[model samples]
Target: MDFEEDLANDSEGALLEGTGKVASNLSDREEILQSLDSIHSQINQELNTIGQAIEHVDAEELPNDIEEFSVGLSDYGAELSQFIDEYRHNLSAQSEYFETLSSEEADFADITDGIENVNETHRAMNAHWYELEDTLISMQEILANFEMPTPQEEGE
Candidate 1:
């Protein structure tokens, strides 16, 4: 199945069966990890773009761009909040989705690495920026993936 795609299209409706309106964009445990990684990359890329733009920005141009990006980040943060809300909603179910990692392909490791990227990007953003956008990243969501490995290793 298109595992990664599964997360992106996760249903955003209220979880009548379990938790509150937490964003659980995943039907499987691996999807949780996958979604986290996907977000991690996106956030990192945005941060990098902001950082680079800031460096060469004219003194006069910097403030305006910063404000615009800050607003954009607000929108992004809201989106992530929704995603997490969905995530929590899914996890609220008593039937845990965790299983032997053997179900996942090696490509899934790329998702785990994406989690690390979240940590690194968070750190870099924190060091560089002075606004909430710099540190608004959720580190644990991505870090959680490390415990879930690829299918090959889990089979052993």
Candidate 2:
């Protein structure tokens, strides 16, 4: 059978029947713990299966996966961090504007400026969101195209 089927079968068999009811007393808690233990065992078994499968995978594919992950991370991580910092700064400035606007001495100019600042910050956030989304989509496409080479292919 395929990996997914094997995993599903193993996991399904590990479930404690009627586990949907909430645990109230000590006995129920013990049952829950037992269920958890069963699940953990299944997870460990599946992890071992996965490790064995990885061992059989083409060695070159591993480096490609790492490179893909690293490139995507490097491309987005710094820019996203910087953008978040700028957003935080803008939010802090907006908070100060709100504090000022709450005062009796605050004028209409302050209100307009505050609104403009908030709108600008929102626009920047939306723009950055789209860029991040595009980056994720591109990376997902790369992942979709990637495949573990079969033993036959690896042999060739």
On lDDT, the leading prediction is 2
**Model 1 poorest ten-residue lDDT run:** 94-103
* lDDT values for all models: 0.44, 0.52
Model 2 stretches with alpha carbons more than 4 Å out: 1-65, 144-156
Candidate 2 residues 1-156, lDDT tens each?
Answer: 232232234324311221211112223545544554464455455344434445666566654565446545554555655655665566556545544644557677876877787788779877986886687578668657665554445556
Per-residue alpha-carbon lDDT of candidate 1 for residues 1-156, written as tens digits (9 for 90 to 100): 333433333343122222222224334654754676577567656556555555555445444446465456656655555555544553443122222111234256644664455456546444433343334543334334423223334335
> Can you tell me which runs of candidate 1 are displaced by over 4 Å?
1-33, 59-66, 78-82, 92-156
